[model samples]
Target: MMSGGNLSQYLAKSIAVMVFGSNDYINNYLLPSIYSSSYNYSPPDFANLLLNRYARQILALHSVGLRKFVVAGIGPLGCIPNQLATGQAPPGRCVDYVNQMLGTFNEGLRSLVNLLNGNHPGAIFVYGNTYGIFGDILNNPATYGKKILHFLN
Candidate 1:
């Protein structure tokens, strides 16, 4: 218990950055490669399941001590180089299904964040629009473009 100056201040001011939803939804639920979870739940139902779980985790943190949370949603999952390399889509294009599913998942995540912020007192939950930012970059690469990259490479 080394409270040199004030440990309560630090604990009270703690901010949690939760960046998830891509793996659980994309790898386990959305991918067509046949994941057990995917077979068990439909797209929308899977999105609900993921969002519900994420919200529970965030609320648990909120209940304990932390308040400010930066909850980041999934980006354009199917737009990566690997999906493009499947040869199923035209060059420099992404698989539409995965991207669409990601968007749906993001909507649920954003709504959950909003609901959490409303329910919790003095809790500041900032929903990180990861998908929006990446979508903008992909759509207008010249404006906001960076080479070399992600799950693809």
Candidate 2:
């Protein structure tokens, strides 16, 4: 049987994994015809807005006794199947524009990881390089024992 303090300590040791930002871009920001975000803010501004909220959310978790975190950044949105299906890219390429916008968000996420670790004592925040890892896999699929399949229109 664990006491209240012991239970809290045990819970704190459990790492929390957080991933966000993809749906915001693909479902909201990119759909200017359906959303006003594109008109209200540029890509960089949108990314900043997301990071501000993200920082707060993470802090809220920290305040609740979560001391270990694994925060993953948004991956290459342009390379995803849904984006690729839009037929914006050339025969065998990704939508660079979407990827670039996501890059801004991912970069800010990296900074957020550093900021959280430095500002909060006794708390550890690790940044998952999801963007880099996904990009590498997309760029060199063969190296990872798989090949990207391209479709014909």
Candidate 3:
């Protein structure tokens, strides 16, 4: 369940910055409520559920005069370096099915944003693309000249 607790804190604290990110799988297939236990719908059947829900939430917030929010769409999950490294196939090969799922999720998110923008005059929803940035880093880590390592410290 997505909560507005952080947003409330931001409003109270007068914070001007907020950031959000979504995992590839989540962005694509899971956002829709169809995948939810409350709904026994399949992936393709629940295609646009997530986007529609997000739009509704945005509109509800806007009705209360809460504007200025950022929502990010998912990125290409199939191309992550972790996926590539773990594969026994050729280099740079991504999992097509996973990417397709993410594509669906992003599509839904974009549709939701469009619906909110079109219906409400004062609604402010900024679409951030965190997936692309992370994907770029994963693709070419050396370009940033920073080595990322995971260890038990």
Candidate 4:
């Protein structure tokens, strides 16, 4: 058995940084041909499903002494080159429908941070607004300087 000193040291180093869920949308939800997620659950419902699972997983980690978490929200999947290739969006434009759906998921993830922090005293949970950060970079390219590249056919 670990003494309090060793336990505290281990917990201090057990920071968990989780950034994911893009595949759930890009690989599953958007692929109606191969996956039934879109037909089976509405966007909000899907977000709830993911959030519920996320809460359980984080709680499991907390039960094991993980006290710090940095959860990054899903970014703009609509702007992916693969999604752009689908032609559902206009040339050089993102699939707003897909982004909007993921936006619902991101919002829930933000709430999850608050919920976890409120319920677990002394546990630290941070919500990284990657969506907002990425969105700003996409929306105002000039603010960070600009570059354009052409793809070969």
Candidate 5:
């Protein structure tokens, strides 16, 4: 992936940029199931794992020459229309535990970005803090602007 971006500079002379979102499958689905929880149902731990993996990927990308890109980490999955639709039951409210996971993940991402920038000279990794931006919208539906409410139902 890094090499492709590097080489694209000559063909089109345009910087080939790639944005990676959500290391969730590895962190949220696989790690928690295998290491933290037995039934594969815990959401908080899964969220943490997702964040950790994201940090690692960012570091790996910086290690290479693919430093002229941004990484948009996981958004507020709890408020996502899909999760809200699926989680509408007795406790139809958005899951706090899941949100917590997102918080941790964002924190880790911020730290990783700072670390990369501080340590590496020409590192251009931008951490898009989507969680903080969307948290309020999730809490206050009336304040929602032109955002599309994602609904699985």
Candidate 6:
């Protein structure tokens, strides 16, 4: 049970930030040193599994009163410093395979958000182009007001 008030009543006026999906595939499945998620679950089927669960969660949130949502698409996991340090990709490039998976997941997430908006009345979902944003920062930090991408030695 909610403490302050009814969920639907409270959510009716709040903006929810939805950011999820990444670790399971990246750290767990994709990384060679970690658990093998690819062996257990393929991308297409795993995406479906995630969507089904995510939809239930969103609907639950909507049932409580949430009407507006800012859903952040997963960023470029392969381009992160740690991943780069792992030697999977060339020093100056992002891991294409991991990034490809993230892209596919982002596409599915976008579709899911659209589907949720269609099912729930008055719900607004804004898909943040985090992937694009991250890419810009990586390829050209100056565009986002930063001078350059500072790679650590």
Per-residue accuracy of model 6 over 96-149 as CA lDDT, tens digit each? 777887766788888887887777778898888899888878887777775774
List candidate 5 stretches off by more than 4 Å. Answer: 1-52, 86-92, 139-153
The regions of model 6 sitting more than 4 angstroms off are: 1-7, 32-34
How accurate locally is residue 13 in candidate 5, as Cα lDDT from 0 to 100?
30
TM-score of each: 0.83, 0.90, 0.57, 0.88, 0.60, 0.85
Candidate 4, superposed: residue stretches over 4 Å from native: 1-8, 145-153
Clashes of each: 0, 0, 0, 0, 1, 6
Q: In model 5, what is the error at residue 41, expressed in angstroms?
A: 11
Q: Report the lDDT tens digits of candidate 1 across residue range 1-153.
A: 748346545646998999987778655665657778777887788888888888788877776668789999888877876566666666567778878877667888888888888888788999999988988876766675565343332
Model 3: per-residue Cα lDDT over 1-153, one tens digit each: 425776664543331222322441344343344345214545444445655565666656565446676777666655655444546335545656655655665666666667667776755666666666766776667778897541111
- Superposed on all Cα atoms, model 5 deviates from the true structure by an RMSD in Å of 5.4
Clashing residue pairs in candidate 4 are none
lDDT scores in order: 0.76, 0.87, 0.55, 0.85, 0.56, 0.76
Sorted on TM-score, best first, the list reads: 2, 4, 6, 1, 5, 3
Ranking by lDDT: 2, 4, 1, 6, 5, 3
The residue pairs in collision within model 6 are 7-64, 8-64, 8-65, 11-65, 12-65, 29-37
Question: Cα lDDT for residue 84, model 3?
Answer: 46
66, model 1: CA deviation in Å?
A: 0.5
Instruction: Specify the highest-lDDT model's number.
Output: 2
- Error (Å) of candidate 1 at residue 147 is 8.1
The number of residue pairs in model 3 that clash at the backbone is 0
Q: Which stretches of candidate 2 lie over 4 Å from their true place?
A: 1-7, 146-153
In model 6, the worst 10-residue window by lDDT is 144-153
Model 4 over residues 1-153: C-alpha lDDT tens digits?
999789977987788998768888889989999999999999999888888888888888888788999999999888878788898987767889988998778999998999888999989999999889888878776677665242211
Candidate 1: lDDT of 137? 74
